[model samples]
Target: MKAILYLPLCMVLMSLNLAGQYAIDAAGSYVKNGAYSAAYSVGEVSTLTVRGVHSTYVSTSGVIQPDPLSITGTKNPGIATIRIYPNPVNDFLRLETDRTDLIQYVIYSMQGSFLAQGTVRGMSVQLDYLTPGMYLIKFSLVDFHESQSFLISKL
Candidate 1:
């Protein structure tokens, strides 16, 4: 009957719509056992390369599907971990560190210009009055360095 045929067609269309909004699990997407375990949503006309923990995965959505490459012996050796919160920061940026011996932090513009530099203690720093732009924040200890790039939008 017409009703039975339409039901299957309608279900197929609904499934396609849901697939477009799929979100991959962030924690489970980590590299597993020296293999590429993450699923990235890439564009049909662009190429993407994900590099992490001494390994690299390259993919071209509409082209060739290649295996991820493993680069051994490039693991991060420093313990000076840095975390930034309120990612899409508005007026303030908070920083936390696992190492208490942090000596200082340096904020830089995307073009490598020094924006601000200062000492921090107790694992937190508040940044204010920053214009809308992208920045590279570097957390430093005696011989360890971890840099993260972030964006700030004032709206």
Candidate 2:
């Protein structure tokens, strides 16, 4: 019964392009997800560094900054995988993947409505135009596919 209701919504969202336009309200804050969560301000270095290649994170203000907390020791990103942090996304979302292969990602509303979809470019996605709410992001890799939901908070 519930599947019937959500099926159409998912289908419709898939049909729509990955461009969602809505006014974003409130200031962005830090949201840590699990042990691998970090959010830096407009011009601050993040503590989470891996493989000497520190990955930059997107601020709720939609600003991108460096991710190097220190410069003494070097580290390598242990696992070659994809990671999306600050589940409660806003302003901008960072999409990180160790592989350079083509991966398609789609953002959908909790109700299964498609919100955004596109290829990961520079490991980030702009969300300043989306309304605050819960959303699901589905990533399509070459060998497998996965979906994860996130809360888009106005604050």
Candidate 3:
């Protein structure tokens, strides 16, 4: 008799738990059409906005447009795209970019103390002197009009 009474209660509790797993709760607004969608959320702590073009095909290719807004507090129209490689680097870090102008770089500790600064010579920077750890490197054009920073690991 007790088993029969507990069976229905157990099933009810199990159903409520299972239903919560599929619950969809969204706090922000999302608009979707055929190929483009935009979402934005405003909260007391922070705000986020996203806009993108959807790719329909299975190949998964879409035109990536450059973000016109500059987040570096610079007046430049856009930030230059730079590539750094051989991360978790052993000795040297290489920088590659299409810009012909000189670029200045500064290496700083994770605690925000300046460690090193120099121009990219031969498209590479000798990081062997840095101790094994994580560092932040900021790269800015010679004009100082635009800059970007990346986190890198040294090993």
Per-candidate TM equals 0.41, 0.41, 0.50
- Overall local distance difference test of candidate 3: 0.76
How many times do residue backbones clash in model 1? 0
Per-residue lDDT, model 1, residue 10, is: 94
lDDT of model 3 at position 49:
43
- Please report, in order, the local distance difference test score of every candidate based on alpha carbons: 0.62, 0.61, 0.76
Best by TM-score: 3
Q: List the residue pairs that clash in candidate 2.
A: 18-117, 22-129, 51-75, 51-76
Better of 2 and 3 by lDDT: 3
Candidate order by decreasing lDDT: 3, 1, 2
33-92 in candidate 2: lDDT tens per residue? 433345444423333333445666543333433343434665554324668766677676
TM-score of 3: 0.50
Rank the candidate models, highest TM-score first: 3, 1, 2
Q: List the residue pairs that clash in candidate 1.
A: none
**Per-residue lDDT over 1-155 for candidate 3, one digit per residue giving the tens place of the 0 to 100 score:** 99999999999988883533121223446566544566544333432344458633322122223323334453544567789998989899988887867999999999999999999989899999999999999999996488889999999
User: Largest lDDT belongs to which candidate?
Assistant: 3
